[model samples]
Target: MFGDGEHDDGPRVHQQRSEGPGGQSAQQHQTHLDSIFMLLEENIVTFVKNELKKIQTVLTSDYPECLESQREDEEVLDGEDEEQRSSREAFLNISLHFLRSMKQEELAERLQSSKSI
Candidate 1:
């Protein structure tokens, strides 16, 4: 009886249930999986938003000073090297993209698309 594909060393409840006629149906299993995926997506979105908020706070509060300090350091090297400057600019662009992706409208659109699937 335990030879069924769904039956194995899975969680004790699932393993036991899979051996019985009262086991969850495939539709129920798929729904449960979908809900789990939705919950994980929401958690990831929350984490990204919180981290972006922290970064935005830091940037707003200290960005100018940070830039000034970077400029001073760059002057010592006779202005920033081309490669280093480009790398910094690329990092900034990626950060901006993440921030935009977390915006309410963008998130709402993504949620809508996910729900339709």
Candidate 2:
């Protein structure tokens, strides 16, 4: 329905889009699986760092004058507020559930063991 050298960049292009839920392509699904798998293998150093930043902000904002002068040796979980702890726990469980849904029993078990600790 087009000239020899022309292309259809309208409905035809849209029709070729992924049928996967949330409009994710096959490659996207593959990348998601790979990412979760890597997270399982890497054991959450990144997650801990992120939690540290959040905890630091909350502590400094609440009692800056006291904490800012202390220079204390602190850990990420040392000042974890209830909400932050809950968020971290929820993420672990969500990841575990996703792994299980993908039939990754081994990874799910690993996550479960970690979560218990």
What Cα-based lDDT does every candidate model obtain?
0.54, 0.62
Model 1: per-residue lDDT, tens digit, 1-117?
866667656568744433223477667777888999999999867855754543344444345655564444446445557875565445445665665677755443443332111
Measured by lDDT, the strongest candidate is: 2
lDDT by residue (tens digit), candidate 2, 85-117: 797778666666777899988756754653222
Residue 32, candidate 2: Cα error in Å is 32
Candidate 2 TM-score, C-alpha based: 0.35
Off by over 4 Å in 2: 1-74, 115-117
